[model samples]
Every structure is written in structure tokens, then in C-alpha cells.
Target: MSTLTDRYVWAAVRSIPEKQRGELEPELRGLIADTTDAQREKGVSDADIERATLLELGDPVRLAAGYTERPLQLIGPRYYLDWLRLLKLLLVIVVPIAALGAALGRLLSGGDVGDVFGALFVTAIGVAVHLSFWVTLVFALVERGGVQRIKTPGDGPLLEWTPDSLPQLPAPAARRQSLVELILGLVFLAVFAGWFVWQQFNSFLTDADGTPIPVLEPALWSGWMYWFLGLIVLEGVFAVWVYQRGRMTMGLATLNLFMNIAFTVPAVWLLLTGQLINQEFLDAIPDTDADFDTAMSYALPVIAFIVIGVAVWDVIDGYIKAWRSRNVSDTAGE
Candidate 1:
């Protein structure tokens, strides 16, 4: 047993943007309440009034279409270029990484040529599907809910529907996103993620005799790796932000300071616990004078000190750049 009101609301909003849903839902409820009240005052049965009110509102799909632009199209013209650019960007980042992974997996498993090609094809298709689904979803939402910016008041509320009015080029230098920086950041993220996954799921690199040597201590896998991985992700965010803004803002600088401190603490723990280098790895060094503990006791602390110093410098660097940029802006304004 379902109320006409509940069914209508769900149907209407199922296509709405998530952010707009809350506001739209309340407005819809208010409208329904008012309509139902008027019908009740006319001495109509509750069930009959509800049906009549809903019927007046008409099909939910058509009603919802009124709320958002391009309801029928997967992606509207306004968002099509951005959608295409993002799709290309995703393919650029993901395809190579997926191809590399497939090739490496095949090589490690001693796969034949046919198997290698098959794996590559499978991975490429999988990556493209994943990229397409997400990118299309985001662009469809944009078509529904994204702002229609008008640089001039002469322009109509809805853009004068024309391909010529669509944005052709990017913003000017210093304001535009850095393509080189973005590509580098993406490449770094891809490499880091791939390496971390390898560390988590597979054995370490093998020696000449195919002996699987472990690079990290067993202690690391317990919990510290998560902390390290989190910092890497945080750093990746900073990288992306830099690419987006073409420079760091005061907010980003502040975050950098906090992240540096947060990252350093766990890193220091790894060094202090002698978990920085595996004991077996230390032993593998031919004619090593110092044992695992001995080497760690002296060398590890120096490395830790260097790491801390570098982190402090990074914090200082971020703040200095932020301050300089702020000062430049203030001076230019004057």
C-alpha cells in the first residue's frame, strides 16, 4: 500500500541532482499538502482527491524534465566538450597504466603472445567502460544541474542555443590549469598506486635465481602502510590542486603544513621501530659489516633526521610561496 504523493515524489526526484534533491523535496511536499488540503475542503474522498491532484501534475518524467535541461539526452551540448575532454584525459591516464599492468602480469606468469594480447584487450575494454560510465554520469549531472554562466547581461538566461557560443579555448596564463602539471601529477599517481598495489598484493622483485625478496618489514603491513598510503593520497590531492589552480593558494599551503606534520610522525615511527628496512634484506648485502639492528641504529636515525628536516623545509616552502603570492596580489591591487 503506497500513497500517491510518495510515489510521485520518488519518481520526480530520481533524476534530480543529489545536491538539489533536498530543497526540491520540501517544495514538492508543500505543493502536495496545499493541493490535497484544497481537495479535502471540497468534500472529496481522500483517495479520490489524491489521484486527481497527481493526475493534474501529470507524468513524473515530463514534470522532472521541466526542472533540468536536456532531460532526454545523455549529455547536452553545453557539457559535451568538457565530457569529451575528460574522457580523453581518463583514457590517457588509465589506458597506459592498465596496459602496463596487463603486460607485466603476463610476463610474470610466463604468458604466451596470444595470452598477452588477450589480457591487454580485456584490460583496455574494462578501463574504457569504467571511464565512460563515470565520465558520462558526471556530465549528465552537469547537464541537469550545472550553472549556465553569462559573462554579459545582454545574454539570455538560457544561453542562446548555438555551438558558436560554446567555450573555444582555455583561460589566460596564470589563471588556466597547467596541462603539463596535470599530466605529471596523474602519471605520478598512477605509478604510486600501481607500486603500492604491487607491494600489497604480490611478492617483491626476484633475484637472478628467482628468489622472491621482500622489500619492507612484515611489521609495516599491520597498520602503518595505510597511514603512508593516506599521506600519498593527500599529496596526490595537493598535486591535483596545484594543477587546477596553476599555483598554490593560502588554503592549500595551510593544508600542506598540516599534511607534512601528519606524514612525518608515522614515517619517524617506521624508522625508530627498525621497520624501515627488512632484516633479511640487510643480510642479503654481500659481506655486510653491520647486522640489521646495528645498521638501523646508526643509519636509520640519520635518514629519519634528514626526512624530518626535509618535511620542515617543505612546510616552510609552502608558507613562503603563499605569503609571496598574497603580497603580490595585494601590491597589484594597490
Candidate 2:
């Protein structure tokens, strides 16, 4: 009767040994039914009753832990190394890139040093929050049994942790996350950031009337402009980092995938709100008699689709590179 209860039971049993599922499922269901019925005898509504029942069972992951006789740490000793490796990898790769992008963007825009540092400070915090939240969440899922850990370096029958056994050594092919690529990426980032900032400051492109119309309408977005620029800078930085790191790990790929999503979703929303393009530019097109609203209806969806496609490709590309890097490593090892 309770879908929530069913979901909870399934989630709790999912991480345990499969042979135990048959014995546990019915037992779990009966337990849910009893709890729900008892609550129903009181004045609790169906929703609240369902919530209470699930609460009594505790966290689904922890419950699964109980069944499997596993400890309930956010990440167990078995996975701590992998989790830490990923956390450090992302932080090392993401933070500097983000900060540098912000610094470069702010500086090229003729912003003062204080403002540039301010931007860097904000970017660092933003990147750290993103890394911390996602890394913790992934490990939490792994803890709950929703995620499975892949073997890391030195994971063998007699594996023991040591400074000499540190997983910092990337596979031979992974070394392809080359400095040359990073330098090239930095150039591209600088150009893109400079271009956008230039667009913000000047309107070199004009209609037949010789009147200047800005590429982006400044006033159309009162508060969102800052966020949009930040997004652009964040993406640029992420690209720089990705290009530098020839080898990608699963966690790193996943983080980048979600970063692309996080960046795209809000950007798409802002674009859909009809705030992305300048109305003045649209109206000023000498040959086109189309008004702002009419032009938007025809153009926005196409633009949004393009943006979405690019974002999706970025996410996929990260994983593809990771796969290729792994393949290269495997071949070299053989």
C-alpha cells in the first residue's frame, strides 16, 4: 500500500548479499505493514504514517548495513582510500582552474586587483563546496550500498597501505594529462573570457544605421548577469583542467558530468526566460522586421537546444576520455 515503504525496503536490501533478499523482502514488507497499521489506528494521515514508519526503520543505507553486518561510516576503511583519492584529485584539479579563470576574467575586464582577488576567493569557495558536497554524497551512497567501489591501485590479496604504495602515480597513458594541453587550454580560456568581457564593454558590430547595439543587453538581467558570467568562467576553468588531465578517473568524470549539468540547467532556464539576447539587437536587424517577442519564439528554442547539446557532449566526452585513458593504461600494462 505504501510505495515509500516498498522503495525503502528495496533500497535497504539492495546492498546485501542477493541470497538474503528472498528472506528479507517479505519480512521487511510485513514489518512496514505492521508499522503503518499501528500508525493508522492513530490520527496520522497516510503520508505522515508512511514517513513515521520509514523513520522507525532508520536510514535505508544504515538499515542495509545492519542486514549485511557492515559498519555505517560515510565511507568504510575499504573505500576510504579511493574516496580520498578522488576528493583530492578533484580539489587539486578544479580549484586552481576555477580561481585562475575568475582571476583572468576579472583582470582582463579591467577590474581592480581587489575585485579580482574577491572573484578568486568566491570561486575557490564555490569550487570547494561543489567538490565537498558531491564527494560526500557519492561516498554516502557507496556507504548505503547504492554504489559499488571499483578496485584501486594496490588492491590485492595482501595489499597494505604505505607512502610508497600511494595511488598518486597515474597509469602511463594517464600521464597524457599533459602540461602542453593545459597551456593551450589556458590560452583558449583567456581568449574566451576576454571576448565575453569585451562583448560586455563594447558593441563593435552594428546595424546599417551605424548605431551601436550591444551583443548582450545589460539591463535585461539585473541580478542574473553576475551568475551567468560566473558560469562561463567556471566552465572555462573546468575545460582547462580537463584538457590538462589526459587521464580521468570515474569520480573525476562524474564530478565533471554533474558540473556540466549544474551549469547547463540554470543557464537553460535563464535563456528560456527570454533574457539571453538583446532585444535592441533583434529589433535593429535592418532587413528583419521581426519584433523581440516574435524573434525569441523562433530563435530561443534552437539556441537552447544547441546549448544543451554542447553540455551533454561535454559530459559524455569526459567519460569517453576516461575510458580511453584506462584502455591505454591497460594496454601499456600488458
Candidate number of the best TM-score = 2
- Name the weakest run of 10 consecutive residues (lDDT summed) in model 2: 157-166
RMSD of each: 19.0, 18.8
What value does the lDDT take at residue 108 in candidate 1? 56
Displacement of residue 24 (Cα, Å) in model 2 is 54
Candidate 2 error regions (>4 Å): 1-181, 204-211, 220-222, 239-246, 290-296
Q: Report, for all candidates in order, the number of backbone clashes.
A: 0, 2
| Tens-digit lDDT track of model 2 for 1-334 | 2245555665567657889889878877887889888888887896577766766565555556666677644466445545665888778778867876786688669775467658877998999999989988877675566443244333221123221111122434435545666667668767866766677657866767776677776663454466556666776676666554435656567777756655576567657875566767766655664474676687888989999998899779779977876554444322
Candidate 1 C-alpha lDDT tens digits along 140-235: 765566555565233122322321111112125645446665677678867876676575345555556767556677566665566567678868
Residue 90, candidate 1: Cα error in Å is 33
